[model samples]
Target chain A: MKDKKPMKSVFKAGAITSEFIGNSIYKHQTKTSIGAHNIFLGQVRADDIKGKTVSAIEYTAYEDMANQKFHEVRESAFEKFDLTCMHIYHSLGTVKAGEICLFVFVSSPRRKVVFEALEFIVEAIKADVPVFGKEIFEDESHQWKLNS
Target chain B: MLITIKYFGQIAEVTQKEEEQLEVSKGSVSGLLNTLNTKYSDLKNKDFQIAQNQELVDLDTELTGAEIALLPPFAGG
Candidate 1:
């Protein structure tokens, strides 16, 4: 059976706060059927480039396409794994170093499914989404970040 | 035909604008790229992919008067 369409917005302005993350986890407590939950958080790193350190990442995206791609990833994951639920949130605008930029949470009745599904969703997001990031240096200069 | 082209991220920076409309004769995606390359010389040096109507298309793909977007390298997590 096809999964229901994902109606939630995956993009959030600025950073994904720990409070928000905590609340999300708290909300999932009522789903007693879900025995395992796996979470992946992507944090911005302060990488030194030519003696300049990255202070923040300014993100931008073709919003319509990104959302569509996110939905496709979710659907594919559900079809491949027996997941109970999954959530993905990505930050737009400026996210400071050490702040969360991406969060992927997956739940399943079994631990193995959650583990495999989380990695699949994360990898798909990195490779397929049209979101872009500009690395702002401490010197005020900036460079585009390429997925490696 | 009048085609609307959207630019994102560093590609937008190089173009110095978010989007533009151009009147062009019937042509392929490569033909559109040639026109844009002439209009914005800086874009020639950048690496990017082209999306037509929100889906990635080959340069040889014919222009169907769809919304075109120039997307830079994805760094999304």
Candidate 2:
């Protein structure tokens, strides 16, 4: 079935907790039409830049445009794949290293559709969405993060 | 024409503010950039793309929309 949900704000103020993620999974049990569920979680990495280490990432976005892009991505995914439901959540404020910053859940009637849809959505977000991240170093310095 | 400009990420740091409205002559995207680059001198050194009405537009595109955004490289996941 085609999903015709309205545009939603995918941003959360802080890091996404495992409890929230687990609860999300728990909430989907009643949707027995979904035979497979695929998830993609983007965690903040403690990357070493030269001599310093990244401690956290503070995210910001062009909110209106980002939400619009997310809507377009979701719509296209539904058109391309047979999915039961899909959800996307991204961190807005500071997220510590090793914490989840993005959670994308896609459920479908088959395993292949979920896998393909999840990848398409994630890649589209990385390339098209106008979300910025400031990587704060352990020493208190910061640098803008660029998706590579 | 008066246009509202939004600066994001590194572009905002150069502009020192996130949003501003400017009175500009009827022109193209590059014309608006020329004005901004003059207003915020450091803007030329930074890398960014331009969006008109939330959609990316080339510099040669005519200035048709009132809202323009200077977007630095996206880092979303």
What is the TM-score of each candidate's chain B when compared with the real chain B? 0.96, 0.96
- Cα lDDT, model 2, residue A74: 91
Say which candidate scores most in TM-score: 2
Model 1 chain B poorest 10 in a row by lDDT: B19-28
Q: Give the alpha carbon lDDT tens digit for every residue of B13-34 in model 1.
A: 9899999999978989999999
Question: Candidate 1 DockQ category?
Answer: high
Candidate 1 on A1-148: residue-level lDDT in tens? Answer: 2226546679999999999999999998888888999999999999998899999999999998899899999999989999888889999999999999999999888899998999999999999999999999998899999898
lDDT of each: 0.93, 0.93
Instruction: Report the poorest 10 consecutive residues by lDDT, candidate 1 chain A.
Output: A1-10
lDDT of 1: 0.93
Candidate 2 lDDT at A133 equals: 96
Positional deviation of A69 in candidate 1, in angstroms? Answer: 0.5
Residue range B1-77, candidate 2, lDDT tens digits: 88999999889999889999998888899999998989999998998999999999999999985699999999996
Least accurate stretch of 10 residues (summed lDDT) in model 2 chain B? B57-66
